[model samples]
Target: MIYKTDMKRWLDLVLSIIGLLLFLPIILIIMILIKLDSQGPVYFKQRRIGKNKKEFYILKFRTMRIDTPHDIPTNLLLNPDKYITRVGRFLRKSSLDEFPQIINILKGEMSIVGPRPALWNQYDLLEERDKYGANEVTPGLTGWAQINGRDELPIDVKAKLDGEYVKNISFAFDFKVFFFTIAKVLTSNGVKEGRSHSKSL
Candidate 1:
């Protein structure tokens, strides 16, 4: 099947390039900060499911210590607040840790707006993704889920919103989310527990 790339893809390319340009300094600074805070690689790379069920390595700034626990959320029901470092908390609250994902966007593995990708280890959530059409589009750095309820919403609900976004994606909708994302970041509104700061899903 010849899948049509949405017009939003071009927008994604443009915005991601711009994001990289604007945030390059921020990225560098975060790298230095992370190295100073912990004795691990500055960037954390992990496998994530993308469009058509393809796998891609998602990039994030390392926020935890070298000895940080690796249990996927489902496997361990403990609170993430305990494992996160002091620097990690600030990086997460400011969302500076997510800046590395711009590289993923530049590489065509992600979008500036779409469903947030689920980790490959999230088998249960990944299996349910099909029900919400989550695999139909490239995962994003931010999306309806992040703006609406963020970490507060359940995975199933987030998937449903993702599906809705897939069905209704457009240039206008993308702009809406893009601007809303800026507002949310500025106000730090609706960022909930157990999700935003790497909580167990």
Candidate 2:
């Protein structure tokens, strides 16, 4: 597991630095557009469960209105689109909102590929991930589950896919996830506004 223990961190650091440098202009433009399209902070920080079930703040461009309910998953929100700002919709569809997570990767709080971090209040997801030991690894900006189904998948299925990633983690697997993720983002596939199910603890 040298890759997990040693190489992964270094890779995340180097790639994140490169990604930030490459995306700087786009990031600044998004920041300005977010500010102009909404009356809230340019960035949104949410507490999420990271490796070993520890808590860390995950950063994204603020894609929702200031009045949106805090700490609740968009899937659980009623008429979630109502809370999304004009520019936010494009950011979500383009996956540009996730660009700030390079900072988390830089901070060693996240990886470039792994299981997506669960919201701090997503108890169902947290517990489900425990069965697969998915919580043992660093959470990611884009992951296996993300490329597979993203918000469209149910919690159990998503956790299982995450577990699959944990069981088969490697450079090869990560490369596949990373490549497919770009495809998913390009097509804006599997993105959903809200789920019909009620939240369960």
Candidate 3:
């Protein structure tokens, strides 16, 4: 039998391409806005761990000033607001910052649904996820942890949710996640409300 995991790979490719094309105009607009709103790259890339503990650069829209400290998790930052650009704040709030990860999906570094990638330096989250076997599958644009509580969830809780997602992988489950993501994005709901944890990729 063709496993759903294989099916999910093809699904990621198809949907990511389609989504890229559909959002191209909006992406361009956002790029221009970011450029005008800040003095830095429109896109940001950071090293993140993918399946099997492989490291890959995750792409995102740059939502922070050029001098923002890199490698530290947002929630650990002492003063996140000092680095967030005006446009970056909006992108983070709308979850539009995540759109650039379509490139990661196309590169097979990620899926549309799975555990969200942890930064390469995020050993705490990385270790927790590894313990739960969440790092065995491709990371995602959004996942069970994202839908459940996002940044509000503790590291261990996030890993548990990710593990649960892996166990429940299916076309139906993915569809369910897709719809919930749309709803969250539209309502700007479930996202952490503080800029303290909204720095960059």
Q: Can you tell me which runs of candidate 3 are displaced by over 4 Å?
A: 1-3, 193-201
Query: What is the per-residue lDDT of model 3 for residues 117-179, given as tens digits with 9 covering 90 to 100?
Result: 888888888888877789998888888888787777778888899889888888889889988
Please write out the lDDT profile of model 2 over residues 1-201, one tens digit for every residue.
Answer: 998789989999998998899989999999999988879899999999999999999999999899999998887787877898899988887888889999899989999998999889889999999999999999998899988878778889999999999999889999999999999888877877756632211
Q: By how many angstroms RMSD does model 3 differ from the true structure?
A: 1.9
What's model 2's lDDT at 36? 84
Query: Per model, how many backbone clashes are there?
Result: 0, 0, 0
* Lowest-sum lDDT 10-residue window in model 3: 192-201
Q: All candidates' TM-scores?
A: 0.87, 0.95, 0.92
Residue 185 miss distance in model 3 (angstroms): 1.9
Relative to the unseen true structure, what is the C-alpha lDDT of residue 116 in candidate 2, on a scale of 0 to 100? 91
Which digits, one per residue and each the tens of the lDDT, describe model 1 over residues 131-185? 9778878888889888887766677887888888887777777778888988887
Candidate models: Cα lDDT each:
0.76, 0.88, 0.83
Worst 10 residues of 2 by lDDT: 192-201
List the candidates ranked by TM-score, beginning with the highest.
2, 3, 1
Clashes of 1: 0
